[model samples]
Target: MAGGVLGVGIGIVAAAAAAAAGVGAERLVRARQTAIDLGVEDDFVDIPDHEAAVISDAVPLHVEIDDPSPGSPTRQPTVVLSHGYTQHHGVWHYQRKALRDAGFRVVLWDHRGHGQSEIGDPASYTIEQLGRDLHEVIGQIVPKGPLILIGHSMGGMAIMALAEQFPEVVSERVVGAGFICTSSGALSTVDFGLGKQIGAAVHRLGPGTVSRLSTRQKLVDTALRAGRDVEDFLVHRYSFGSDVPMAVVRYTADMIFQTPMSVISAFMPTLLAHERTDGLAAFDGIETLVMHGQQDRIVPRKHADDMVARMPHSEYIVVEASGHMLPLEHPEIVNTEVVALAERSCRAVDSGKRRARGVPRNVTDLRAGGRSRRTTKRAAAK
Candidate 1:
């Protein structure tokens, strides 16, 4: 009897798997048909550079430069900033100021369907498309020069995907990379908290009528009100380590709220299933930095630790008193390391030689009397 019971259980599991596969295939077909009806391509297609070069699609992309002052420092290396899921480029306002002061050009842009970027047909937005958009951005901005790319959360995944899918661009142009509060693979492992919950839901939904309905203004407003307390609860839990400024918190919350659910449904699954563990190979010969809040409840610090292990030469930082939003939560710390890395990378390129790189540094280490200890040691040796 026990053997028969086990067999029945296995059969049930198999049937469920088959049913899920059928549902997924049906969803894809329906989504494709919807795309055709809307006059959008179902597959990833390169968006042509328009006359004004305005980033236009069903989703709009916006770009901002902190310092466009010509002739200030033409050779200064540029740092491209990519914000995470449900966030716009505005989240980097604090870091942007510090970066400009550090004498480096900064490039920040909103992903399609977020911030000032156009949100045309939500059907066209996907992880693959975002990677292509970044490719285009690099082609236009960095061109033949080296670039330092910084990505937060979803943005980090997008950067990794871009490197994986377009190795040529990454090998030729990308000099240094920073992944803050992002996972390289298996995002649904529940270590990423909210990402796991949201990713699974969207994966099952597959971007169809349900996706469009979720993005409707009325539905979002109702959901926001219902989840207001929940929003504050999460903000306090995941957005910082200490008492963060209300403005910064509010700004982040607003950006997230503004992100349509359709966008989330379209790309969340791709991010979760995205396995770019091998993508770091492209940067093996270059500089990389992985920073995450040890206290981060969203994307666990272990993810960053694993990243450093993979890219052993890459700098690994664990911010002690920060959560997932390290860029905003600890802007000073992030700014210092990013600027210093940019300087080192730029000098190496300018000298027409790669220097023997030094020990991988961490923001938290520099903060906790590490710099003072180093200074004292040098003095004693002298």
Candidate 2:
């Protein structure tokens, strides 16, 4: 359901998906299928790719600048990309390059314990602490600018924390916000697209299970490393919904696996307790866009709806057949929407007329873009 299960559950299940491959292809497929029936991850486990996908380049990500929201823009508006749990700024690979090409100064930072950032005190792993950390990142790196804050998964929660803790950040200087594959709160209640019984069971028990596993951190890491192929497959399966390049799948795996089981467990409890719907109010008059994958078993689209309901005027998008990692699975759509958000934010600031503070008078309008989806009001509430 959340990273707690994604990290530890994958460890427990990856062994099944890949370890059994030596037994026989049929058995391997069955084990993979069992993981799928649980509905805990993305298109995660249907079977392995026999074709042997290949990638030509192995480019390293260059992450610069860090942290949370707004202030008046002294120059070109800055776009801050916040990634989810078990991920680093690398998660925004496609979007970062696209945004930079689009001419906006983009900033990215790992949440404490993620990517280049050092893991702080275990006690500081809560979303509240992440929010404060984001504030610090903004102060130190971005300095002065009208910010367009974009968050995915836990990163989205951190943005909500920003809204809650520093209202002025959202109202005074933040021109736009983009919430991707994130929930407003009540994470424990949803079944993660698994049936009610299974979903409830996983959410209830997953965190504690992962925490216990973290105590044997080395063993867990060993299991995780042993399941390297499985990790790549699962990352593709759970993180993305559509067909992504095998290289992209492995890249995602690298980013997530680089994170230790300890850090994953450190943040689990807070994620389970995350409830920041009240923070949605901070972006009241600012330009806001909320996106999620319709097929995302993790942090389902309904959660995006919960956010839109609160910020009636915020734009809502759902990429069809997509999973949790929207930016990676459907880069064009995410890039287009992000560019539009930045443009809107800049215009809003320049015009000095913040959009009206209320729900859009019209219900969400779904535009047919063929391969790319333009979700409006959860595709008119689907």
Per-model TM-score, in order, reads 0.73, 0.79
Q: In model 1, where do residues sit more than 4 Å from their true spots? A: 1-60, 68-75, 120-123, 191-216, 223-227, 355-382
Candidate 2: regions farther than 4 A off: 1-7, 10-63, 66-75, 356-379
Q: Write the per-residue lDDT of candidate 1 for residues 287-356, one digit (tens) a residue.
A: 6777777677656777776776677767666666677778877777788777766777777677765432
Lowest summed lDDT window (length 10), candidate 1 = 1-10
When summed lDDT is taken over every stretch of 10 residues in candidate 2, the lowest stretch is: 47-56
Highest-TM-score candidate: 2
What lDDT does each candidate get?
Answer: 0.61, 0.68
Which clashing pairs does model 1 show?
58-120, 58-121, 59-118, 60-117, 60-118
lDDT of 2: 0.68
* Tens-digit per-residue lDDT, 59-121, candidate 2: 122237422123423336788888998887777777765666666777777777777666566
Best by lDDT: 2
lDDT of 2 at 247: 59
Error of 1 at 101 (Å): 1.5
